[model samples]
Target: MSDLYIGLMSGTSLDGVDGVLVDFSSVQPRVLSHATQGFDDRFRAELLQLNTSGPDELHRAALAANELARVYALVVKRLLETTGTQPAQVRAVGAHGQTVRHRPQQFDGTGYTLQLNQPGLLAELCGMDVVADFRSRDVAAGGQGAPLVPPFHQALFGQLPGVTAVLNIGGISNLSLLNASGAGSLIGFDCGPGNALMDAWSQTHTRQAFDAEGRWAAAGTVHAGLLQSLLSEPFLALPAPKSTGRDLFNGPWLQAHLQSFAHVSAQDVQATLTELTAQACADSLLKQAPDCKRLIVCGGGALNTHLMSRLRALLPGCDVASSAVHGLPPLQVEATAFAWLARQCLERQTGSVQSVTGARGARILGAIYPA
Candidate 1:
C-alpha cells in the first residue's frame, strides 16, 4: 500500500481548524484534499476565555473539547468525501487540539502544556484511529513541548542548499533552522507573537476578526517606541528550547505594554504589532542562524503581504517566501506535518526533535485513540 493519513490542526490563532488528507505511499507525501472550519465569534471567545482561569473551567473545557472534536470530525468528513476515501483507508488522523495555555518548563520544574482535545471522541466520530496530544511527552522529558514542526520541515525541505530556515507564523511565531553547517545543525524555537496580537488588536479597534492581508497595518505607521517596548520582552532574548502562547503574550500582556503608549493611535498600534512579529523572527534568525539563506514562511502569516514585506526588508540577505513555492501552501504545511506525525506514530518512530524541543531524546509523540 497506500499510506493515507489525515491531519487536523487548530493552532494558537484560535481562528479555525485546518485538515488535510495526505498520501505518503511514496517518498514524497502529497496532499490529496484539504478542508477548513472557522470557529464562530461566540465559540472563539469561549476558547480564549478558557485560556485563563474561570468558574467551572474543568467542566467548560470538557464541553469545549467535545465541540472541537465535532468540528474536527466535520473537517475529516469533508476531506474524505472530497477524495472519495474511506475511514479504514486512512492509517490515522492526527489531531492537534486548540492550545489554550503553553508554559512548559515553568512551575514545579517540569511545567505543563495543555491542548484541549477529545481524541477518543474524534476517533469515534471519524471512525479512524486518531493520534492526539503530541506535546506532553516532550514536556515530561524536560522539553518545551512546542514548535513541533521543525523535524517535519527538515524532512520536507532539507534538500535545499545552504542554511535554510522555515518560519511558521501562526498565532505565535517559530523558526526551524535546517541543514546548518556545524554545531546545532537543527535549531527551532518560539520567536515571538505572530497574528495573535495583531488579530486581537484589529478586533478590538475595527471589530474585525483579522487585518485582511494586513491592509490596516500597512495603512498605519509603525511607532518606533512601541516597537522597541514590544521587543524588550525577555522571552525573545531567551535561548532555544523555549515556547510560548496566550500564557504570556495574551491581551493582558499587550495592554500592559500599551499602558504607557496610551496616546498611540489604534492603527499605529496595529502597525507596531505587525512590526514586532517581523522583527522578532528576523532577530532570532540573525542571532541563532545568521547564515540562513532561504527562509520559507508558512501558516496564516505567510498570506500577510505587509508582514512578508517587512520580513524581507528586515532580512536583506535572506530570501523570504511562502511554503507554497515549495509545493505546500501556507495553511496545508502544518496539517501535512501532522499527517506525517500520524505516520510516525503508527510506525513507532520518533516524532519530535530533541534539539528543537530540548527533550531528553527523540520520543514517539502522541496518544493513539483506536476506532
Candidate 2:
C-alpha cells in the first residue's frame, strides 16, 4: 500500500513556503505534486526583524505562526485537490516551520534553537497528522540538528559505488558525503553562506530581494582581496558535524567584514560574496572529502548560472551538476526529503545519521501531532 505525505518547508531565506506531496511505499518514494507559496513583504520584514529584535517580537512570531499555518493548510489543500488525495488517505504532513533563531552553543546554559510553528494549529487546520519540531531533539542529543538531508541523500543517491557529495545551497550551505558502501557511512555539515549573503547584499544595494540569475554579480568584477578577507571568517575553518544559520550570516556579520570598501559598488560586493560562497564550498570539499568523485548540487543556488560556473571552475576534475541530473529538482530536494523523513517517523525508524549529526546514536526524529 502507498502512503501520501505532505512536506512543508520555510527556510532562512524567508522567501516562501514549499509544499510537496509525496507517495511512499515499502519500495521507493515519488513526488506526487508540489506548490510554492510566497510570503508577503510585511511578513518577511517582520520575520527578519524577529531574528534580531528582543522580547517584544514573540507576539509577532505567534501571529506569524498562525499565518504560516494557514498558508501550509492552503498549499496542502491545493496539493490534495490536484493529486486526488484526501486527508484520510494521507499519512501525515512534515512541517519544517520557520527557524527564527539558532544559537547552538549559546553562552547561557539554556542553549536552544527556535522554530516558530504551531503544529497544533496546523493539524487542526489541515485535518491530518503533523510531525514537526524536527531539530531540538538532535541538539538535545549533542548534535547540530541541521544538514538533516544527509540520510535522505543517502537513501536517494547511495546506489553508485563511489563517493558522492550532495551539496545543498539554501540560506546557508551544507554538504552530505555519502559512501556507496552503506547507509551508515554518510557524513555532513553546514559549509557557510549560500544565497544568504548575496541576497542580503543585493537587497541592501539594489533594493531587490535577490540577484536574479546572479546577473548583478556577473556584471561586477570580483575583488580578490575582499574575497580573501571574507573567507578568513573562523566559521569556515570550523570542524565538521557543525551547522550555522542567519544568526551567524546576518547584517552585523557583513558589517564587520565591510571595511574601507564602503564605497565599492553593490554589484561588486555581490560578486565578491558569490565568489566567497563558491570558494568556501570548494575549500571545504577539498579538505573534508577529497575523494569525492561526483558533486550533486541542489537548493536555490543551483539555479544561479554564474554560481554554477564558479563551482565548476573551482572544483575541476570532478563531475559537478544539479540534482536534476539524478532525478531531483534543485528547489524541491529539501521538501522532498522531509516527506521521506515523515515516512521514517511513521515506520519508527531513525531518520538522521549519527555520523552527520554527532549524535550518540541514531534517533527517530520529529514529534507527531494527530488530527
Candidate 3:
C-alpha cells in the first residue's frame, strides 16, 4: 500500500482551508504539494456567526457543515491535481473541520468540543477514506482535547539540544514544549487568543480580513490601560492542559472590555490587542518552559511581521523564528500534522499525549470513514 495522505485544516480564524498531500514512506514525511483556498467574505461571516447561538442554529449548523465539506473537497481536488497523484494512491484525508465550539470540561463536566465537518461527505466527494473528529476522543478520556500538534512537533523538532517550543498562532494560540530527552518530556496546551481578536478588530474598523503583516497595529500605539484590561481575561491565567476558542474571546467579550475605555482610539486598540496576543504567548512560555531556548512559530499569525517582532521583544532569552526556517512553512505545519495524525489512526497508534492533554492515557484518535 502507498503511504500517501491528505490533510485539510480550516482553523478557528475561519480564514480558509489549507490542504497538503504528504508522502510518509520516509522517516521524515515530505510535503508533496500544498494548496490553499480562502473563504469568501460571505462564507466567512456565516462561519463566524455559527460560533454563537442563533435562531434555528441546529439547521444552520448542519448546512454550514455541508458547505465546509464541499470546501474541503475542493481543496483535496487541488492537492491531488497539483501533485498529479490519484485518489486511490492516497491512504486517507485528515479533515480538522472548523471548530464552532470548544468548551471542554465545562457544564456537564464532560463538556463537548464541536467542530463543523461532514467527513463522510468529504470522503464521498473525494473518493478517499477520511479521518476526523480528532478531539472528541481525547475529551472523553478527560483531556483538554487540543494542542494536538505536539506529538507531531516532537517528531519534527524534538532532537534539539535543549527545551524547544513550537507556538502555533491561529485564531487561538497553542504551545508545544519539546525537551531534548524525547516524548517523555513533551508538553503542550493552548496559550490564549492568537489572530482572532486582531482579525475581528481589523474587519470591523479597516474592513480587511486581517491586519496584513499586522501593519495596522504597527502604525498604532499600544494603550497601557486597554492592554491591562485585555490581559486580565481569566483564561490567560488558567493552568496547563487548558484549551479555549471563540467561546471565551469573541466580539461581545471585547466589547465588554472596551466599555471601560471608550476614549481609546481604534488604532491604539489594535496595537493593544496585538500586544495582548504577544504577552499571553510570552507569559505562557516564561511560566511553563522558561528553559526554552528556541521558539519556532507557525500558522497565520507567523506571517504577521509585527506580531513576530513583539514576540521577539517579549522573549529576550529565546531565539524566535518562523517554522519555515525549520523545514515547513507556517501555513503548512498544522496541515502536515493532521496528515501525520491520520497515519497514526490507521496504524492503531496513539496520537494524543498524556502530559499535553491530561488525558487518562494516550489514545488513537479520529473516526475513519472508509473509501
- TM-score of each prediction: 0.98, 0.96, 0.98
- On residues 214-270, what C-alpha lDDT tens digit does candidate 1 reach at each position? 999999999999889999999999988888998999999999999999999999999
The backbone clash count of each candidate, in order, is 0, 0, 0
- Ranked by TM-score, the better of candidates 2 and 3 is 3
Query: Which consecutive 10 residues in model 2 have the weakest lDDT in total?
Result: 103-112
Q: Which model, 2 or 3, shows the larger lDDT?
A: 3
Model 2 agreement with the true structure over 252-354: per-residue lDDT tens digits: 8888878756777777899999999999899888888776779999989999999999999998878999999988788889998888888889889998877
Candidate 2 stretches with Cα past 4 Å from truth are: 108-110, 180-184
> Please, what's the RMSD in Å of model 3?
1.1
What does the lDDT come to for candidate 1? 0.92
